[model samples]
Target: MSCSEDPTCQELLDHIYELVDADEDAIDERSRALLAAHAAVCPSCRDAVDAERHVRELLRRCCGESVHAPAALRVRVVSMTTRVRRTE
Candidate 1:
Protein backbone atom coordinates (compact mmCIF):
# COMPACT_ATOMS: atom_id res chain seq x y z
CA MET A 1 0.00 0.00 0.00
CA SER A 2 1.10 3.54 -0.62
CA CYS A 3 2.18 5.78 2.24
CA SER A 4 -0.91 7.89 1.77
CA GLU A 5 -3.12 4.85 2.24
CA ASP A 6 -1.21 3.66 5.30
CA PRO A 7 -1.89 4.72 8.85
CA THR A 8 -0.76 8.23 9.76
CA CYS A 9 2.43 8.92 11.73
CA GLN A 10 0.55 9.51 14.97
CA GLU A 11 -1.36 6.26 14.58
CA LEU A 12 1.84 4.35 14.05
CA LEU A 13 3.38 6.11 17.03
CA ASP A 14 0.50 5.11 19.27
CA HIS A 15 1.08 1.52 18.31
CA ILE A 16 4.84 1.68 18.74
CA TYR A 17 4.57 1.90 22.50
CA GLU A 18 2.23 -1.10 22.50
CA LEU A 19 4.61 -2.86 20.16
CA VAL A 20 7.52 -2.15 22.43
CA ASP A 21 5.54 -3.34 25.44
CA ALA A 22 4.64 -6.74 24.03
CA ASP A 23 6.21 -9.60 22.14
CA GLU A 24 5.96 -9.09 18.37
CA ASP A 25 3.96 -12.25 17.96
CA ALA A 26 1.48 -11.09 20.56
CA ILE A 27 0.47 -7.94 18.66
CA ASP A 28 -2.52 -7.98 16.33
CA GLU A 29 -1.65 -8.53 12.67
CA ARG A 30 -3.38 -5.35 11.42
CA SER A 31 -1.47 -3.08 13.82
CA ARG A 32 1.78 -4.81 12.99
CA ALA A 33 1.12 -4.31 9.30
CA LEU A 34 0.14 -0.68 9.82
CA LEU A 35 3.28 0.03 11.78
CA ALA A 36 5.41 -1.82 9.23
CA ALA A 37 3.92 0.16 6.37
CA HIS A 38 4.32 3.48 8.15
CA ALA A 39 7.84 2.70 9.21
CA ALA A 40 8.76 1.69 5.66
CA VAL A 41 8.05 5.19 4.36
CA CYS A 42 8.61 7.50 7.34
CA PRO A 43 12.21 7.68 8.45
CA SER A 44 11.39 9.41 11.70
CA CYS A 45 8.77 6.88 12.74
CA ARG A 46 11.07 4.09 11.66
CA ASP A 47 13.87 5.48 13.79
CA ALA A 48 11.54 5.96 16.73
CA VAL A 49 10.22 2.42 16.53
CA ASP A 50 13.71 1.05 16.04
CA ALA A 51 14.95 2.93 19.07
CA GLU A 52 12.05 1.69 21.18
CA ARG A 53 12.62 -1.89 20.04
CA HIS A 54 16.34 -1.56 20.75
CA VAL A 55 15.65 -0.35 24.27
CA ARG A 56 13.16 -3.16 24.85
CA GLU A 57 15.67 -5.74 23.67
CA LEU A 58 18.41 -4.28 25.82
CA LEU A 59 16.14 -4.30 28.86
CA ARG A 60 15.16 -7.89 28.16
CA ARG A 61 18.80 -8.88 27.93
CA CYS A 62 19.82 -7.08 31.09
CA CYS A 63 16.78 -8.08 33.13
CA GLY A 64 17.16 -11.73 32.17
CA GLU A 65 14.67 -14.09 30.54
CA SER A 66 11.49 -13.19 32.44
CA VAL A 67 12.05 -9.45 31.94
CA HIS A 68 9.69 -7.80 34.39
CA ALA A 69 10.16 -4.69 36.51
CA PRO A 70 9.72 -4.55 40.26
CA ALA A 71 6.30 -3.59 41.65
CA ALA A 72 7.57 -0.23 42.96
CA LEU A 73 9.08 0.60 39.59
CA ARG A 74 5.94 -0.48 37.79
CA VAL A 75 3.87 1.74 40.05
CA ARG A 76 6.12 4.71 39.42
CA VAL A 77 6.16 4.11 35.69
CA VAL A 78 2.38 3.81 35.57
CA SER A 79 1.99 6.97 37.62
CA MET A 80 4.29 8.80 35.24
CA THR A 81 2.46 7.47 32.20
CA THR A 82 -0.87 8.57 33.66
CA ARG A 83 0.49 12.05 34.24
CA VAL A 84 1.84 12.28 30.73
CA ARG A 85 -1.39 11.04 29.22
CA ARG A 86 -3.35 13.54 31.21
CA THR A 87 -1.26 16.38 29.81
CA GLU A 88 -1.53 15.07 26.28
Candidate 2:
Protein backbone atom coordinates (compact mmCIF):
# COMPACT_ATOMS: atom_id res chain seq x y z
CA MET A 1 0.00 0.00 0.00
CA SER A 2 2.98 2.33 0.45
CA CYS A 3 6.48 2.84 -0.85
CA SER A 4 7.73 3.17 2.73
CA GLU A 5 8.69 -0.50 2.85
CA ASP A 6 11.19 -0.28 -0.01
CA PRO A 7 14.27 1.89 0.09
CA THR A 8 14.23 2.68 -3.62
CA CYS A 9 10.58 3.65 -3.55
CA GLN A 10 11.23 5.65 -0.41
CA GLU A 11 13.99 7.48 -2.21
CA LEU A 12 11.66 8.37 -5.09
CA LEU A 13 9.02 9.45 -2.63
CA ASP A 14 11.48 11.67 -0.82
CA HIS A 15 12.49 13.46 -4.00
CA ILE A 16 9.14 13.52 -5.75
CA TYR A 17 8.86 17.27 -5.45
CA GLU A 18 12.25 17.82 -7.04
CA LEU A 19 11.52 15.28 -9.74
CA VAL A 20 8.42 17.19 -10.74
CA ASP A 21 10.17 20.52 -11.22
CA ALA A 22 10.08 22.03 -14.72
CA ASP A 23 13.50 23.56 -14.14
CA GLU A 24 16.64 21.47 -13.73
CA ASP A 25 17.92 23.73 -10.98
CA ALA A 26 15.29 22.44 -8.60
CA ILE A 27 17.45 19.38 -7.91
CA ASP A 28 21.16 18.64 -7.82
CA GLU A 29 22.49 17.05 -11.01
CA ARG A 30 23.66 13.90 -9.25
CA SER A 31 20.44 13.34 -7.37
CA ARG A 32 18.36 13.97 -10.50
CA ALA A 33 20.44 11.50 -12.45
CA LEU A 34 20.13 8.85 -9.77
CA LEU A 35 16.38 9.23 -9.50
CA ALA A 36 15.92 9.24 -13.29
CA ALA A 37 17.95 6.05 -13.57
CA HIS A 38 15.90 4.47 -10.86
CA ALA A 39 12.64 5.55 -12.48
CA ALA A 40 13.71 4.10 -15.80
CA VAL A 41 13.87 0.65 -14.27
CA CYS A 42 10.98 0.89 -11.85
CA PRO A 43 7.51 0.89 -13.35
CA SER A 44 5.75 1.99 -10.21
CA CYS A 45 8.13 4.82 -9.64
CA ARG A 46 8.08 5.76 -13.29
CA ASP A 47 4.30 5.98 -13.20
CA ALA A 48 4.47 7.98 -10.03
CA VAL A 49 6.95 10.39 -11.60
CA ASP A 50 4.82 10.71 -14.71
CA ALA A 51 1.76 11.38 -12.60
CA GLU A 52 3.58 14.09 -10.73
CA ARG A 53 4.78 15.68 -13.95
CA HIS A 54 1.25 15.72 -15.28
CA VAL A 55 -0.05 17.31 -12.11
CA ARG A 56 2.67 19.95 -12.19
CA GLU A 57 1.84 20.82 -15.76
CA LEU A 58 -1.80 21.12 -14.86
CA LEU A 59 -1.05 23.42 -11.95
CA ARG A 60 1.26 25.53 -14.05
CA ARG A 61 -1.46 25.95 -16.61
CA CYS A 62 -4.03 26.80 -14.01
CA CYS A 63 -2.18 28.97 -11.49
CA GLY A 64 1.42 29.68 -12.42
CA GLU A 65 0.90 32.39 -15.00
CA SER A 66 2.05 35.90 -14.08
CA VAL A 67 -0.53 38.66 -13.50
CA HIS A 68 -0.56 42.37 -13.01
CA ALA A 69 -1.77 43.65 -9.68
CA PRO A 70 -5.20 45.30 -9.75
CA ALA A 71 -5.00 49.08 -10.10
CA ALA A 72 -6.59 49.71 -6.67
CA LEU A 73 -4.22 47.30 -4.97
CA ARG A 74 -1.25 48.75 -6.79
CA VAL A 75 -2.23 52.26 -5.71
CA ARG A 76 -2.65 51.11 -2.12
CA VAL A 77 0.75 49.42 -2.16
CA VAL A 78 2.39 52.49 -3.63
CA SER A 79 0.74 54.68 -1.04
CA MET A 80 1.94 52.41 1.77
CA THR A 81 5.48 52.36 0.45
CA THR A 82 5.51 56.13 0.05
CA ARG A 83 4.36 56.63 3.64
CA VAL A 84 6.94 54.14 4.94
CA ARG A 85 9.75 55.88 3.03
CA ARG A 86 8.71 59.32 4.30
CA THR A 87 8.65 58.03 7.90
CA GLU A 88 12.13 56.59 7.45
Candidate 3:
Protein backbone atom coordinates (compact mmCIF):
# COMPACT_ATOMS: atom_id res chain seq x y z
CA MET A 1 0.00 0.00 0.00
CA SER A 2 2.80 2.36 -0.78
CA CYS A 3 1.88 5.87 -1.87
CA SER A 4 3.61 4.97 -5.12
CA GLU A 5 0.63 2.76 -5.83
CA ASP A 6 -1.76 5.65 -5.17
CA PRO A 7 -0.11 8.84 -6.21
CA THR A 8 -2.82 11.16 -4.95
CA CYS A 9 -1.97 10.14 -1.35
CA GLN A 10 -5.44 11.15 -0.18
CA GLU A 11 -6.41 7.73 1.07
CA LEU A 12 -3.13 7.30 2.88
CA LEU A 13 -3.46 10.73 4.46
CA ASP A 14 -6.97 9.91 5.67
CA HIS A 15 -5.68 6.68 7.15
CA ILE A 16 -2.99 8.61 8.98
CA TYR A 17 -5.69 10.37 11.00
CA GLU A 18 -7.33 7.02 11.59
CA LEU A 19 -4.02 5.75 12.85
CA VAL A 20 -3.88 8.61 15.34
CA ASP A 21 -7.25 7.60 16.77
CA ALA A 22 -6.75 3.85 16.49
CA ASP A 23 -5.30 1.59 19.13
CA GLU A 24 -1.67 0.66 18.61
CA ASP A 25 -2.27 -2.72 17.01
CA ALA A 26 -5.30 -1.58 15.04
CA ILE A 27 -3.14 0.03 12.37
CA ASP A 28 -2.72 -2.84 9.93
CA GLU A 29 0.39 -3.60 7.94
CA ARG A 30 -0.89 -2.05 4.75
CA SER A 31 -1.67 1.27 6.42
CA ARG A 32 1.69 1.32 8.18
CA ALA A 33 3.43 0.61 4.90
CA LEU A 34 1.53 3.34 3.14
CA LEU A 35 2.34 5.82 5.89
CA ALA A 36 5.99 4.89 5.93
CA ALA A 37 6.22 5.20 2.20
CA HIS A 38 4.43 8.53 2.18
CA ALA A 39 6.69 9.90 4.90
CA ALA A 40 9.71 8.80 2.95
CA VAL A 41 8.67 10.57 -0.22
CA CYS A 42 6.42 13.41 0.95
CA PRO A 43 7.79 16.18 3.10
CA SER A 44 4.31 17.67 3.32
CA CYS A 45 2.86 14.58 4.96
CA ARG A 46 5.79 14.38 7.35
CA ASP A 47 5.28 18.03 8.26
CA ALA A 48 1.57 17.39 8.74
CA VAL A 49 2.32 14.63 11.17
CA ASP A 50 4.75 16.84 13.05
CA ALA A 51 2.29 19.72 13.11
CA GLU A 52 -0.51 17.54 14.45
CA ARG A 53 1.77 16.37 17.27
CA HIS A 54 2.81 19.91 18.04
CA VAL A 55 -0.79 21.09 18.14
CA ARG A 56 -1.66 18.31 20.57
CA GLU A 57 1.20 19.39 22.79
CA LEU A 58 0.16 23.01 22.61
CA LEU A 59 -3.43 22.17 23.52
CA ARG A 60 -2.26 20.14 26.46
CA ARG A 61 -0.15 23.03 27.68
CA CYS A 62 -2.77 25.72 27.12
CA CYS A 63 -5.91 23.85 28.19
CA GLY A 64 -4.93 22.53 31.61
CA GLU A 65 -3.10 19.36 30.57
CA SER A 66 -5.78 17.59 28.55
CA VAL A 67 -7.75 18.19 25.40
CA HIS A 68 -11.24 17.05 24.53
CA ALA A 69 -14.10 17.99 22.26
CA PRO A 70 -16.72 20.27 23.72
CA ALA A 71 -19.84 18.56 25.09
CA ALA A 72 -22.05 20.36 22.60
CA LEU A 73 -19.92 19.15 19.74
CA ARG A 74 -20.04 15.59 21.05
CA VAL A 75 -23.81 15.70 21.38
CA ARG A 76 -24.14 17.11 17.89
CA VAL A 77 -21.91 14.39 16.54
CA VAL A 78 -23.96 11.71 18.19
CA SER A 79 -27.19 13.19 16.93
CA MET A 80 -25.81 13.43 13.43
CA THR A 81 -24.65 9.85 13.51
CA THR A 82 -28.04 8.71 14.67
CA ARG A 83 -29.75 10.63 11.93
CA VAL A 84 -27.43 9.19 9.30
CA ARG A 85 -27.95 5.69 10.62
CA ARG A 86 -31.71 6.11 10.58
CA THR A 87 -31.57 7.38 7.02
CA GLU A 88 -29.53 4.38 6.00
lDDT scores of the candidates, listed in order: 0.67, 0.64, 0.57
Choose 1 or 3, whichever is better by TM-score: 1
Higher-ranked by lDDT: 1 or 2: 1
Candidate 1 positional error at 86, Å: 29
Ranking by TM-score: 2, 1, 3
The segments of candidate 2 whose C-alpha lies over 4 angstroms from its true place after superposition are 1-7, 22-26, 66-88
- Model 1 gets an lDDT of 0.67
- Can you tell me which runs of candidate 3 are displaced by over 4 Å? 1-8, 20-22, 64-66, 69-88
RMSD of each: 7.3, 16.1, 10.4
lDDT of 2 by residue, 1-88 (tens): 1324333877876777677663577777767777778888898788677656555454457668554445475446445554654588
Model 1, 1-88: lDDT tens digits are 2346577878776677666665566667776777787788898787677666655565577887667667476446555554664588
Order of models, best lDDT first = 1, 2, 3
lDDT, model 3, position 41: 82
lDDT of 3 by residue, 1-88 (tens): 3436543456556665454454457677666666767766887666555544454454567776646757475446445554654588
RMSD of 2: 16.1
Instruction: Judging by TM-score, tell me the better candidate of 2 and 3.
Output: 2
